[model samples]
Target: MRKTGAVPVISGAWALPNAPQFSEGIAKAKELCRSAGGTFAVLNVEGEDEQSQSVLETAFRDARSDEWKEFLADCLKFEAEIAKEISIEKFTFAELEEEEQSLERLRRWFRDLKKRDALQLPAAEQAQKALNSCIDSLEAYAQSVYSAQNGGE
Candidate 1:
């Protein structure tokens, strides 16, 4: 995920088998936060196989500490920089004319809003499930094709 000014917390299983990759993820999150002038944190899960909802809650709370004042400040500061505003709702409609830019921006924002509204409907939830299934199937097929082309290497 692209980094913003928000504090990042990497929550993962740090088992011996995957400790290196876990450490790498932590390092990357730290670098992203530091580059964006924000602090970084981590939630080191003990059991590789065990998991819970609290970990997610704790990470979220950690990021939004101080009544969200720090996060708000960081976000405002980051959003002020012209070159770094590429997140959702942050797209600058770069290099467009004044009139076209405003129109396009509103159009995209409305489209996203409509999508959010649609996702709250039952039909959209069913469609999302079907789309996820199709994606998984396609991914498996692609992997099979790649493996075949590699002579089962």
Candidate 2:
């Protein structure tokens, strides 16, 4: 018997530290689904699924709200502090020349955090623990931006 359920597909472009292009990411996800012998369907928040649409609308709306903007700003401050502690000069969450470079900067910080014996320090420990959260928040912010730009297409 074949499995029957919605298979969640995500594009690598949706990964953190990289700007998300929703149309391209969705296209890639659909292609992956097809190659895996599965069907793909785009979820439209304003479409037939009223309940799901309402939920999505609320969530996206909140994400675009001032609170969300402040949260992202705070996250960026945390990232910058971590970067500075790790000696990553000029570190920024702003889109860089190459997406990979932004990712590499995070990777470098993580590595330095691990190799250093000064994890007992407050700043180092904060930076070490914030790695995952930083990435997650960044990804969410990227998705919010994408949804706004594409009108959740």
Candidate 3:
């Protein structure tokens, strides 16, 4: 989502009544991609009745097109800068007082990437894997600390 050299495809579903908001979301997403120096396409499915199925089918067809495939391939190249900005080792979970803050920061970073829709990139996925590993280590450290403080209760 940080404009890593990729084309992002934003998809959404909305009832006919909320079409305006759905369109706005797509527009905003497009702008975000553009600001990041990338291109974006949108697939907005609208309707609540049987027509909805047809709309979705058409969307599916478009999604399966060669153009969409190229778009996805392009998106895979996105490189998230946060992956380099935050080092997992920096949050070692060594002190009980700092453990919560460390976890919160890691979670916030992860959530920000997700909100920015960067999870689709391979780099983002790698970052997520690293983040999960750090979270696991931190949780284990917290457990050990708790056990030590509470006599393993």
Could you estimate the TM-score for every candidate? Answer: 0.25, 0.31, 0.37
lDDT of 2 by residue, 1-153 (tens): 001111222452111111132355456667888899987665432436888546544443432343324433555775664445335332333442233355456656455333322112344445544556767644554554455556656
Model 3, runs deviating above 4 Å: 1-94
Model 1 Cα displacement at 6 (Å)? 35
What local lDDT does model 1 show for residue 144? 47
**Greater-lDDT candidate between 1 and 3:** 3
Candidate 2: count of backbone clashes, pairs at least 3 residues apart or interchain: 0
Error of 3 at 142 (Å): 1.3
Specify the highest-lDDT model's number: 3
Model 3 lDDT tens row, 14-37? 221223323545567679878999
Evaluated at residue 16, the lDDT of candidate 3 is 19
All models: lDDT?
Answer: 0.38, 0.44, 0.45
Q: Tell me which residue pairs clash in candidate 2.
A: none
Candidate 3 displacement at residue 64 in angstroms: 26
Which candidate do you rate higher for TM-score, 1 or 3?
3
lDDT of 2: 0.44
For every candidate, C-alpha RMSD to the true structure in Å:
18.1, 18.9, 11.8
Best by TM-score: 3
Candidate 1, residue 66: Cα displacement in angstroms equals 46
**Tens-digit lDDT string for candidate 1 (42-142):** 54545443355455444434433432343234333422332232222232223223323433443343333223231133433333343344334334444
